[model samples]
Target: MIRAYAALEKGGELKPFEYDPKPLGSEDVEIDVEYCGICHSDLSMLHNDWGMTQYPFVPGHEVVGKIADVGSAVKKLQVGQRVGLGWYSRSCMTCEWCMSGNHNLCATAEGTIVGRYGGFADKVRAHEAWVAPLPDAMQPVSAGPLFCGGITVFNPIVQFDVKPTDRVGVIGIGGLGHMALRFLHAWGCDVSAFSSSADKEPEAREMGANHFINSRDPNALKSVEGSFDLILSTVNADLDWSTYIACLRPKGRLHFVGVVPNPISTEIFPLIMAQRSISGSPLGSPATVTQMLDFATRHQIEPIIETFSFDQVNEALEHLRSGKARYRIVLKH
Candidate 1:
């Protein structure tokens, strides 16, 4: 039996719950969760904001744990091996995207919490392919968010083929943006940070941003026109996107990793004239995550995080809801 905190209904408080899972499949592994990160996606799912959440939901996707059990066919991961799991727990191994090493793009990929119990528990299970082993140099307690937020931001750099010499801009100096600033800087790009908050300028710079643009100021936005090779928007809030579109150089791209609830509205002319493009991506494939983890280990880059005991999960959730988390929150068991 697995013991976990679960919401009995939509918008309900999480309470103690337990269940016996079916026998593990041949390719499955059970993880003894050591730490789990609280993501905005967890909050969204808690309230059924996406309208796809199931009741008795255990909402955690950013997981770091040691393998407690593995099925007969598991090979790469063994019991007692440390690992991390992200938003996705499984994908059909036979799909074209999976075959091409783009399993995150698999149409039938299974979300960690979509219709299943997740990692807010004593133990959780996932297919072997989605479980990424943590490099020995990485700290397990703070590595959970890297599986999700870290990968979400890092995948774009790889997928878009962002170059070391390119000028890159990151919007919103929060969870994903902070990591973007660090990664882009380490990648040797001239990195800029765009934030509505003036207070974030110093922190953004500290995180490796070479320039800071006050996103709230029109003139500040105008000054950098046609300057960036790529601008990664990591904020969910809607802003003057048309202006952002204009900030792009010819053939530049404006990519989104944030989950903005409303429809994006921007003039098509700017994009048409400049050959600029707007795109968005979910978390990276497992292979991409491995690369990201390796890079982070090599660069000694880690998310700015605050920790809480698993017993205080509700308080941790409230901290994240209040927007007071230093950047990311981790729950230690």
Candidate 2:
């Protein structure tokens, strides 16, 4: 039996719950969750914002833990290895995308909290392919967010071949954006941070931003036009995206890792005239995640996180709801 805190209904309070897990398959492994990160996506699912959440939901996907059990077919991971699991719990290994090493793009990928219990409990289970071993130098407590938020931003840098000499701009200096600033800085790019909050400038610079742009100021946005090689937007709120597009150099790209509620509105002429591009990506493949962890370890880059005990899950949720989390929230088991 797996013991966990679960919401009984849509937007309901979480209560203690237990259920018998199915027989562990030959390819599955059970993780003794040490720490889990609370993501905004968890809150959205808790309230059924995307309309696919199931009741008795246990919301956690940014998991850092040790393997407590491993199926016979799992050869790479052992019973005591430290590992992390992200948004995906499983993907059909036979798919063309999976075969080509783009497992995150698999059509039938399984979300950790979509229809299954997640890492909010003492234990969670996932296929070996979705489990990534943690590097020895990486601290497990602060490593949870890297599996989701970290990889979300890092994947684009790798996929788009962002050069070290490129000028990069990050929008929204929050959970996802802050991490982007750190990684891009370590990658040797000239990093810029764009935020509506003027107060974030100092922290953004400390996080590795070379310049800070007040996103709310029209003149500030205009001054950087035709400057950036890439702009990574990590905010969920919709904005006048055309202005951001205008900031890009010819052949530059505006990428998104954030989930904007509305369809994006932008001018096509800028893209056509300048050869600029607009794109977005989900959490990265396991291989890319491993690479990100190694890079983070080398650069000493970790998420700015606030810790909470699993028992304080509700309070932590409310704190995140109130928008007071310094950057990311982690739950200790």
Candidate 3:
């Protein structure tokens, strides 16, 4: 087995050390990681926030790597091809979600963190069936976040059949929100960026948003009432759905992709009043991931990221957790 450096979760802290590679199965491909994106879910998993977590966890799902070696059964991928692996690394292919092309929710869905060792290291093994080919338009390190942040935002936009002229509102201007703005703007929509912080206005506008609204102001809420065709929420903050619901025009759809650990205390009255619908989406289907890459390549759309070395993972995570990253953070080998 090859030895690579990995940052492990030890006593609630990540410490760097050597780890061994497991024997490759016929369906597995060994990858030499070029970049790994730090995800918010990694922090949640590291702390056992969702409860089922294994220790010594190597937490990263947004991985971009090169095929260093492949097992005999693998035919579709060749050595040296650049590829990206996302949150869902494996799945039970016969489930309803799989049959419907929504592999992100397969009940036995295998997250990169949950099953195999993740990409927070120099080398990783991934399922050949789950890796996506990188388009020529994206740089390897620059593309890591696309597997998570890009696919997460683009899937809901596609599932909703967002149109060119649709009036779109994106809440929360962090990593997901910034990417949402990029996608929505590129889709030819009238995009409005929402944030509770007034300081986010300049960067929000630079990301191609036509309007920037500070949701804390009562006047701002009044002007936005019934003004949106769709609202894609990317914030983890506790929300008063009534306020957001009022911002939607009749028959509008609101999709929430963020996770707030607290149960959403939303009232159902607005659902009946305006026939509005609320839904949640996980990362994209394997098929949709390919489509998103194609779109990103064609439109010259890419995420802005700060790069860190493999050993500096802790600093990167701290930056992300402390809300200092401009948009996304990635680690390079």
Candidate 4:
């Protein structure tokens, strides 16, 4: 039986729970979770924010752990190997997207928490393909977020062929945005940060932003018109997207990694005349995740985090819900 903390009902506090897992599939592996990161998505699921969360929900996806068991068909990973798991647990390996190395786009991709118990536990199982090996240089204590938030931001840079010489802008200096700034800066881009918080200005610069644009300042937003080759919006809050669109250079792109609850509205003339584009994506593919790990290791990029014991799961959830996390939260066993 796997021991875990679970929310028995929607918006409920987590409590100790246990259950016997199904027979492990030939391609599956079980991880003895050492640490897990608390993502906003976990809080969202805890409250059934997406209306797809299951009862007795075990909400954690950014998992860093050692392999405890492996199935007969699993080849790349071995028992006792350190690895990490992210938002996805499984995907239809034969689909076109998966065959083309974009498994994150697989039509039947399984979310780690949608209908399954997740990593806020003593053990969690996933198809080996979705598990990423941790580099020796990456510290397990702070590596949990790399599997989710880190990869979410890193994938766009790889997918879009963001150039080192490109001018890049990042919105929101929270979890995803902070990492995006660091990655873009290390990639050699001229980085700008768009934030409404005055206190975050210095913090943004420390995170690698060369310019700070106050989102609330019309002059600040207007000064950068046609300035960016790419702008990555990492906030879930709705903003004046049209204004962001205007800030993009000709043939530029405004990409989203955040899940805004409302539809984004923008004028067509700005997009048509400038040849600008608006796009969004899920997490990265397995190959991309590996690349991200290697790049992060090479550049020494790590998420700023606060730690909590697994026993303090509810408190950690509340802290995240309160929006008080410095950048990320990790739960250790």
Candidate 5:
């Protein structure tokens, strides 16, 4: 067995330490991690908030690594290949969702957070089907955030046909929101950033937001009513949908990738009057993940991130929880 170094969340909070690697299975490929993005989802899993967390859980899903070994039957990947893995670490390939090509929504779709150990360690084991070949030219640390944060926001951006000329509004300027702004701006969309913080205005502009809407200002929101062709809301806080919907153009699409711990409350006018749609998506299917990577490579689009050494994982998580990181936090092995 390969020895790997990692910090452990020993059924409560994360404490820096080491752990042993599990025996590799035939369908698994062993990876020596170069970088792992510290997603807010990781923070969610650390507390066992969703209630299925395994103890000594190493929380990470946005992973980039080098393939150190592959099972004999593995054909899709080879040893020494640069690779990336996202939220999905495993799924029943013959299941209905898999057959219907919507594995992301599968009832039994096992995640890196549950069924398998994730990339919080120096090495990880995962099925070949769940791993995507990372572009050799892409830097590992920067690419880690793309696996989850980039793809979470990017999948809908591509799926819903929000194009270069569309007026796109991104809500919240934190991890996911920041990436959404960059991706939309890079796509040549007329990007607008919505946030409560006045301080994020300059940073938002620097990240390619053409306009910054301070939600604290009524006039700011008033001017943008029915202005956006698409709105990607990334705030996890329970917010009034009417306020968000007011920013959308007629029949505009609102795609949600963030989770609110509480149920949302909103007026019916936004949906009933405008014919606007509200929707949510899980992370990308394995196929779409690769497509996102290729598209990002072609467009030179990557997330802005702060990197931390593996031992400093606790500090990394604290920074993310405090909302102090630029956009994304990555851990290097």
Candidate 6:
């Protein structure tokens, strides 16, 4: 039986729960979770925000753990090896997308918390393909966010072939944005951070932003028109996206890693006239996750995280909901 904390109803408090897992598959592995990160998506699932959450939900995908058990056919991972799991727990290995090495795009991909118990537990299980081994130099405590937030931002850089000398802009210096600034800066881009909060400027620069633009100021927004080669938005809130589109240079791209609640309303003429593009991506494939971990370790980039004991899960969720978490929250087992 696996012991976990689960919400028995929509928006209910998580309580102690236990259940015997199904017989482990020949291609699966069981992880002894050491720490897990709380993501906004977890909160969204807790309240059935996307309307796909199930009752007795356990909300955690950013998992850092060690292999406690492995299926007979699992060849790449060994028992006691450190690993991490992200938003996806499994994907149909025979799908065209998976065959093309884009498993994250597989139509049959399984979310860690969509209909299954997740890392808010003593143990979690996933197929070997979705489990990524951790880099030796990477610290496991703060490495949880990299599996989700870090990969969300990093995938675009690789997919788009962001040039090292190109100018890049990051909107919202929070969880995803902060990691973007660090990665882009280390990647040798001229990094700009856009935020409504003026106070975040200092920290943003310290994290590798070459410039800080007050997103709330019209003039500041205007001054950077036609400036960026790429703009990565990491905030979930909807904004005057046209304004951001106007800031892009010809052939530049505006990408999204955040989940904006409303459908985007924008003019098509600007994109046509400037040859610009607007796009978004989900979390990366396992291969890309490996690359991201290696890059993070080499650059010494890690999320700014606040730690909590597993029993303080409720308080940590509330802190995240209250918007007081410095950047990311990690619950230790």
lDDT of 6 by residue, 1-333 (tens): 999999999999999999899999999999999999999999999999999999889889999999999999999999999999999999998989999999999999999998899999999999999999998899999999998999999999999999999999999998899999999999999999999999999999999999999999999999999999999999999999999999999999999999999999999999999999999999999999999999999999999999999999999999999999889999998
**Model 6, residue 176: C-alpha shift (Å):** 0.6
Better of 1 and 3 by lDDT: 1
| Per-residue error (Å), model 5, residue 158 | 2.3
**TM-score to native of every candidate shown:** 0.99, 0.99, 0.95, 0.99, 0.93, 0.99
Cα lDDT tens digits, model 3, 1-333, are 544334355425666646666677787788888999998988888777788677667788899989998988998898999999989878877989888987888899888987456888777787787889898668887898999988999998888899998999999998899999989999999999989999989999999899999989879978999999899999888887778888999888788889965776667888789899888989988899999999988888888899999778878889988989878999987
Q: Native-vs-model 6 lDDT?
A: 0.96
User: What is the C-alpha lDDT profile of model 2 across 140-233, one tens digit per residue?
Assistant: 9999999999999999999999999999999999999999999999999999999999999999999999999998899999999999999999
Distance from true position, residue 121, model 2, in Å? 0.3
For model 4, state the Cα shift of residue 107 in Å.
Answer: 0.7
Assess candidate 4 and give its TM-score to the true structure.
0.99
* Backbone clash numbers for all candidates listed: 0, 0, 0, 0, 0, 0
For residue 18, give model 6's deviation from the true position in Å.
Answer: 0.9
Off by over 4 Å in 2: none
Worst-scoring 10-residue span by lDDT in model 1? 235-244
Identify the superior model by lDDT, candidate 3 or candidate 4: 4
lDDT per residue (tens digit) for residues 1-333 in model 4: 999999998899899999999999999999999999999999888888898998989989999999999999999999999999999999999999999999999999999998999999999999999999999999999999999999999999999999999999999999999999999999999999999997899999999999999999999999999999999999999999999999999999999999998999988999999899999999999999999999999999999999999999988888988889999999999
- The local lDDT score (0 to 100) that residue 213 gets in candidate 3 is 92
TM-score of 6: 0.99
Give the higher-lDDT candidate: 3 or 6.
6
Write down the lDDT of every candidate, Cα atoms only. 0.95, 0.95, 0.85, 0.95, 0.82, 0.96
Identify the runs in model 3 with alpha carbons over 4 angstroms from their true place: 2-11
